[model samples]
Target: MFRALAVAFAVVLIAGATTFLALRPIEQVHSSTPVAAAPLRATTTRPTSPPTTTAPPTTRTTTTTTTTVTANPVSVVENFYAAINERDFATAWALGGRNLGRSYTEFVAGFDGTVRDDLTVTSVTGQTVYVSLIAWQTDGTPRYYSGWYTVSNGEIQHGKLSG
Candidate 1:
């Protein structure tokens, strides 16, 4: 179990480091420009003949609308750690969205079969979507982790966990 935990921690650290390194260059290339909206057109047509009994043709014009998307909840992100610390996999799973909830349950079951009390969340930011944490064993040995949480449509869609 100890070996498995060590390997998991190592993998998380490597993955996080790789993601940070990967995204840094992309961030540098980021650009902000407003896209131009399409123009709208209207047309009027004359009827072929003036008739005693006439029906007008229904004309339809379509317009495109743009909307800003909003994000989801902090407790959704917070609950992952909360559930882990409490060993409440069911609650953690329920806290997440369809896919993430299932993933969290699998992760919990795969990782040590239980979460220790030493897991602590140090800080959370950006809709509580980002978290920094320190998880330790009873002996005070530390495991460091950092991850981002994404929420959509009132549910936690995904998370990227690393150390």
Candidate 2:
């Protein structure tokens, strides 16, 4: 009976060991070095005519550049007033008549003895700007004036004045 029990225990231990060895997981090791591939050679259908080579066709490219100029309404009015303040009659006159129909002499005579003390742009409607200003005559009389000035092409085309 003791020999039979010992044989049975030995058989069970051997079976468990066999099962554990068979079910154990396997680990794979990867190499860190890069492997180079072999270069490919082109094959030709015909070995005759010394393998003639043809050049590709040439292409023509055309480029066009365009420029646009736009005038600012406020700058025109400000520059006109600046020319007037500086007593540059010729420049002031040139800055006029895009919309205003006054002649050069008339424009110059209008600014005579009229010193612009202060100017305030009240509002702007399209190309027209309404302004209120304080001016003085040659006799030193202070006057309040308001007017609408129309500008085009950096010039004063027309103006309406009231005091």
Candidate 3:
């Protein structure tokens, strides 16, 4: 009876120890704070040049005088009309800037059957020159017209026609 009771107590103690181990929470021996890893080194054999330094710019004061020479607006308009009256379309077109926005053929066609009879400069304001003119059509009918021409860089840039 004594040996049986001793064997039974030993079995109960072993079972109790196994149950406590299985239910207990596991613990770590190290700290929870993260450890910083060492920086990795690069292996390269490329040659590097030393940094360069530049001198500061010097400060100076100098006076500059500019001169501009422009052709007379009245003369430019007169020359352009003279070319048109002579049926010299190429010269007329050349006298105008790229802003004319018309082809040589179109320019000639627009002036077809038109002859400039007379012209007079009415006024000159800065780059704009105004002129009054009388023209004859193909049927010999007379037409009166007034125009304001804008000249720039020694070339006729644009024009507005009115009656």
Candidate 4:
């Protein structure tokens, strides 16, 4: 790996080629052994050159995105009727039948003479869902209904559907 240093003053060339800024004078010691060493020099005056300048290091940034989706309120009304059409009473109850202002028995009794519920959603205004319903009877009579249902959190809070 490479190493770096930003020297601001005059650089001194010592024995080795490594770069360094000498803050004080350097002297060589006399020895009796025959060891080889480079000559030494000292400097007492401050450097007259201008200081060097460098730009700051660069940085990187990261970002992430997320998305959310919500179901349509009219679909809830469509599902509620779909459960009834499929004869799944418990599913119908949980979907919003319990909020239709009637007991579970009464809710089931309302469809005693009914054979099928062909549901058609006309329009949706905020939390209110309007629909056109054709409830086919066992006697082959098709009953027509048109009304709006109040829905909140995917559940029918109330309904005014009638023939």
Candidate 5:
């Protein structure tokens, strides 16, 4: 578990340092009605340590996380999903995974079967950015979801997303 965590952290660092990153599409929404993702629930909990559990044999297991932030508010949302894609909950939490509305452990557990997230910034209105996401499950099913994320500075403040 610890080795896996190390790999996840390294992935986040390499992704952050790598300059050949894909350019994410950006556009402004001109509609009178803004596309907003309703808050599933807003709870930001910062866990000092990764989650762990004990078994009947009195053995414990550990895990890992990863993240890096950019100044652009929209980029914050992008980074958040990036961490999720890498299965780096630690980095995801730092990148505003807290806004996903769950404790660190629960938040990590939430993406149990999620394989990857293909994200796009559909619109930007001040600190609010609308997003369209395709969450792929391990079974190879793609679920479409659209929502908005409210960012402050480089952290995701809160927002809502639903499929």
Candidate 6:
């Protein structure tokens, strides 16, 4: 359990650093909206008089830019393990997506057993993730299971476990 927790923390640290480095440059931050160049002056012909100076046309420009912070998908998976290991059911349920929230609520509504386990995350690819865990049941039996968790919009959509 200690090892797993350490690894998880390291992964999160690395990911955070990577994101910071990737978004450090000003060009990268403002790449979405390019600045427009100043317009050229119109040429006029005045044979008898000196050239007339006119101030550039007053242009009012309004730009609307939307900024969205994409939630890290791996955090959800990590939170799931962390919350479950800590026996914080409400936190675990919130980590799940809408569907999982409903499903887990229905499944554990009348249950009273606690799950103490260590979770080993095998892989996380986009919205698909895998984890291997060892859980100790109240009856003193060791339960080993592997789970495949599907995530969408940064939340765990659903998860299936097999022993």
lDDT of 2 by residue, 8-108 (tens): 55666676766666566644456797556445333323222332443457898999989665467777777777878888767767777334666677767
Q: Estimate each model's TM-score.
A: 0.42, 0.55, 0.54, 0.58, 0.55, 0.51
Between prediction 3 and prediction 5, which has the larger lDDT? Answer: 5
Q: Residue 125 of model 4: what lDDT?
A: 90
The residue-by-residue lDDT of candidate 6 on 1-163, one tens digit each, is 5555555556666767667765565443356678764443333332333224444579899999998865676777888778777777777777773455356666454234545777788998778888997777777677789988987776788888888
Q: What local distance difference test score does each model get?
A: 0.59, 0.71, 0.76, 0.77, 0.79, 0.68
Q: After superposition, how far is residue 163 of candidate 2 from its true place, in Å?
A: 1.2
Question: Lowest summed-lDDT stretch of 10 residues in model 1?
Answer: 42-51
TM-score for candidate 4, please give it: 0.58
Q: Between which residue pairs do clashes occur in model 2?
A: 99-157, 99-158, 100-157, 100-158
lDDT, candidate 1, at 111: 46
* Top candidate, metric lDDT: 5
Q: Model 2 Cα displacement at 117 (Å)? A: 4.6
CA deviation > 4 Å runs, candidate 5: 1-70
Model 4 off-target regions past 4 Å?
A: 1-70
Query: Candidate 6 at residue 95, lDDT?
Result: 76
Our tally of clashes for model 2 stands at 4
lDDT digits (tens) for residues 42-105 of candidate 4: 4444334434555578898878877554457888888898899999988889878999899999
| Candidate maximizing TM-score | 4
Candidate 2, lDDT over the whole model? 0.71
Give the per-residue lDDT of model 5 (tens digit) for 93-137. Answer: 987878768899998998888899999999999989999999899
Clash statistics: count for each candidate: 0, 4, 0, 0, 5, 0
